[model samples]
Target: MSGIYIHIPFCKQACHYCDFHFSTSLKKKDQLVFALAKELQLRKDEFKDTTIETIYFGGGTPSVLSTNELQYLIDSVYLNYKVTDHPEITLEANPDDLIINNIDALSISEVQSLYKTKFEELKKTGINRLSIGVQSFHEKDLKLMNRAHNAIEAKRCLETATQYFDNISLDLIYGIPNSTNQEWLENIQTALSFGIPHISSYALTVEPKTALASFIKKGIIDNVDDDLAHDQFHILIDQLNQAGFEHYELSNFAKKGYYSKNNSAYWLGKSYLGIGPSAHSFNGKQRAWNVKNNTIYIKKINQDQLPLEIEILTKNDKYNEFIMTGLRTIWGVSLTEVKKQFGESFLEYLLQQANQYINNQMLCIVDNRLKTTQKGKFLSDGIASDLFKLR
Candidate 1:
């Protein structure tokens, strides 16, 4: 089965640590939405024979769009492609966009009714899942990251979201500078308190051009401590496991039967089409990405042209990707599949490189599948890089 990823490249404001391509201005929103639809029609033949099992609305902040605008884009997909019945449709939202304002005069039940009305409208758009970006539940952390939503909005959103959507996922950031392990633990507990089924957490890495990186460079903010991050990651795993969530991937924990189908398709190397600026697509043997500029993207699409670059994957490139994605999940690299797809030499080379990690108890072959040990889960990416067959 395949999937389609729609990139909504607009946000209300910039976050301190984000480097994703987006515009804070909404002046071009209408034109860009139309362009996205046209591009889907223009590329219908690419996935003509593939049944799309997941439709993901990802972005700078997909919640920035109105329900009608979102439905328009979803309708565009149905018009051009063969989507499976009951496909998993996910919209990535920010807490501020999802919550309702509390007017002092309005009763608590009246405010809740407004929230219900809002999310019900979203449900009508065929979005069955909501991935809310609740990076932290701490007020200071929100300011440090320049996230648009405050701590109150984060908690308020989840309180109502869980009442409406069954398949919900929330994001958390573990390694914020100066954040104590206790604070990190509190974040995890706050998320669990909402009964959210899936959680995707990551370290707060300083991307090169983002504001966080510059702040650290100027000594305005301290750099993220790797040692502290390591401690918190383990704390996260322990807390979630005790709560009966599966640590299915490096940064994702899910209750049984609640894993993200869209993201899992990506890790499994299934073909998918990424629509909009700065989105990436992979069709097993090849990969493509659109230009990162919104104006240029709309201009090109209006002219019935694809403003994207494509690359045909070399064998080593495919093998390296498989190894990288494989090691990060509970499902490890398959020795037999490697031999079947890449020949004996590549398999032999992989085993040869992996032998060192295996000897150190960081990796082990169970049922002929090479997987990282619990001790090595945090280092899977570094280990996978060592196993890559460089040309």
Candidate 2:
């Protein structure tokens, strides 16, 4: 259940809300690509005994790279590591990159006809799944977020992508300022129309130093209403559940047999290697992350050095992470496993800390596993922190 995550640290333009490490320039594209392959080769021994089951291309925008560049990286993975026969290879794409023809003038049928070639080229590169970032279907929402594509382009991309890839996922953001409840519902319904097997929806939080945060601070845009976000979160859960999608994690919903293997491995605490700038990796006992600066990452890798920092997890660190990730998903924390792994003292501390929430009916024990009640799902993070064994 191990995986590899490759970060593509480039984008055509910056999204207003994004604070991730990436540059708008393609000047270093070639060097970065070569460095990525070199890094994979250098780190092969780390996963010598592990079989890679998933290869994920995540980013600033992985689709910004050409099919050839993507194929080069995939080839590097096969050359360096042992991959499973049916590894789930995913590419996070934007609608603008997926649609070759002008979406504004073309009909859905016409766009699909023109778009087949691009998707076919992508599929030939061994990419079996596509996670498209179609944040909203309304022009206003797109404009507010400064997304790369319009509402039409989003719909057109999905209309065509569905024909080529069965295992497709789309992203949607809830809790935008000035967005009404009805508008939020419309966004959900429109995404469901695409018939995507998996959906990763998130509440839009204004991170510090991001344009969105600055705008709210200066009155350029209204601040995100917490009450509105809370309402929309419930709206999302109810709508998706009725549509026959499993609310597998706090923010991800999927049809049966379509859960994201890469992400599931992450939550279950499986070992994985993170390649590329700003990517994080985890084994059961330790976690590491690459340098955020692309130039430094490339230079270090070219010099046969890993520009990364490692953190050896203490027993409490592992326990806290398990509780946080565990409570966020349907597969809750196993009390027996906790005692077995972290010992009776750690397990006792966890149960003592969790008793308050359990009494409030926000958390409960089912088959000896600690899980969040529906009433507490939206507050899982807060509850998990409360249950943490802080020193």
Candidate 3:
């Protein structure tokens, strides 16, 4: 089975730490939507033989689109691709879009009631899942991140959203500057109290050129604490494990029945088609990404050309990826599969590289599969890189 990821590269406002390809302007929204539909049609042949099991609307903020506008693209996917009877359709939304927040104009009950109404309308549009961007519930932290939603919308949206959707995932951020371990614990508790089935939490990294980086450089904001982040990560793991959410992957936790199919497909190396600006698509042998600039992407698509460049994976590239992704999740890298797929040479090289870590107890093998041990989970990426084969 395959999946489709449609990127909506527009946001109501820019988050200070975000470097994702997006614009705060909505002037070209309609044209971009039209172009995305056209792009889908153009790339239909790529997935003609596969049944699409998931369709993810990820972005700057998918909630900016009206139900009808969103549906037009979903309809396009159905019209073009072979789809399963039940497909997981997810929309990534910010709290502000999900709830109409004029707490003064309406009572808390009235405001939350409106959220239910809006979410109900969204549900009817065939979206089976909602991924809420509730970065933080503290007003100070929210202001620090420059997230559009305030503390009220964050809590209010969850309280109301749970009423409409069962397959909900909340995105939370840890390690924000000035956020203490206590505050982080409270955030995790607040999320658990919502009874959300899935959470995709991440550390606050300052990517180059983002406002967070600039702020740190200029001494406007305090730098993030690595020790604090380490402490908070354990707090999350302990609390979530106690709450029965599986730490299925790094930065992700899910209840037994609530794993993210869209994300799981990516980690498991399943084929997926990505449409719109800055979206990436991968067939087994090759990968492609759309142009990052909206104007260029629209222009190229309008001219009947795909704006993305392509990369054909070498055997080494594929092998390295398998090891990296495998080690990140609960599923470890299978030496048996490696030997079968890439031959004994690659497998031997992997075992040779892994010997040191395995001896150190940072990793262990189960049934010939390599996975990170508890002490190594936080540094899985670095470990994975060290084991990469040089061609």
Candidate 4:
């Protein structure tokens, strides 16, 4: 099944470690939404009647938009695309936005609880799922990362959310310099305690040009230790497994039935359309991405041209992509499918390279499906790259 992704390219504020495309300015908000609607209509024929099973509103922060803005955006997609009867529509939001105003809203918050009202409105307008960015539950960690939400807000938001929506996913980051093993375990425990069904966790990396990277260069912040990160990665996997969560992808875990349909579709190589600034789309044979600059993206779409770059996948490119995404998931590459799709030579190349890994106990073949051993999971990307065919 295919999906749609709409990038809301604005945030209330920037987190120190974030490098995603977003602007703190709201001046172009209305124009950007209108432009996204226009882009959606213009590209309607790209997928050409494919039934969309999921529509994800990813971002800077979709929750920053008012109900009216969100409603209009969803309506526009419905008007333009043929959506499935029960599509999974997810919105990525932060915790701070869900809380009532810092003051006396607590009395009102205790009355009907504003978080509940917000979820009701969100669901009424077609948001069926939420991917909340609850990066940490430790006050010190939250402050170090410059996150807007406090630890209490993170806990409250999820606890309150169970009253309305059950299809919720969360994000967690590990291996921060200050996070100890015990602290990381507590973080995962806290998340599990919330009963969230799906979780996507990642090791904190200091991307160049981000504030965290500059702090390290200035000696104001310590650089991340690879060994510590690796230690914590194993800890995360073990903890999740013990908790009965399936380690579905290299960085994602889920309860049996709560795997992310949108993300799963991506790993399985299904087609999806991405709308709005800095979004990427892949339709099996080609990939396209919109401009990262919000102003430029809005201007181009307002003038009736999609601000995107297209790449037609070569045979090698396609094969490498399959290997890269396939090897990361629990569902590894199928030798039979590879042979049928790519031909005997490429399949032979895979089998040849896989021999060493197989012999070394890093890769295993069960019923013609090649999967990574538990030890190889952490180094999956490197192994996949080693097996890739050269042009």
TM-score leader:
1
Off by over 4 Å in 1: none
Clashing pairs in 3: none
Q: How big is the positional error of residue 367 in model 2, measured in Å on the Cα after superposition?
A: 0.5
Model 4 RMSD, rounded to 1 decimal: 1.4
Q: Estimate each model's TM-score.
A: 0.99, 0.97, 0.98, 0.97
What lDDT would candidate 1 get against the real structure? 0.95
Cα shift from native, residue 63, model 3 (Å): 0.8
lDDT of 3 at 382: 93
Which tens-of-lDDT digit does each residue in 1-391 have in candidate 4? 6998999999988888999899999999999999988998999998775988998999899889988899998998889888889999998989887666564545754746566677789889999898999998999888878888999889878877767889999999988987899999999999999889898999888987888888889999888988888888999999999989999999999999999999999999999999999899999889999999988998898789989999999999999999999999999999998999999999999999989999998899888988999988888899999999987
Q: Can you give the lDDT of residue 65 in candidate 3?
A: 97
Q: All candidates' lDDT scores?
A: 0.95, 0.93, 0.92, 0.89
Residue 47, candidate 3: Cα error in Å is 0.5
Candidate 2 lDDT, tens digit per residue, 122-208?
999999999999998999989989998999889988988998999999999989999999999999999998788899998999999
Evaluated with lDDT, which candidate comes out highest?
A: 1
Give the per-residue Cα lDDT of candidate 2 at 330.
Answer: 98
Summed over model 3, clashes come to 0
Better of 1 and 4 by TM-score: 1
What TM-score does candidate 2 get on C-alpha atoms? Answer: 0.97
Query: How many collisions per candidate?
Result: 0, 0, 0, 0
**How does candidate 3 score on lDDT?**
0.92
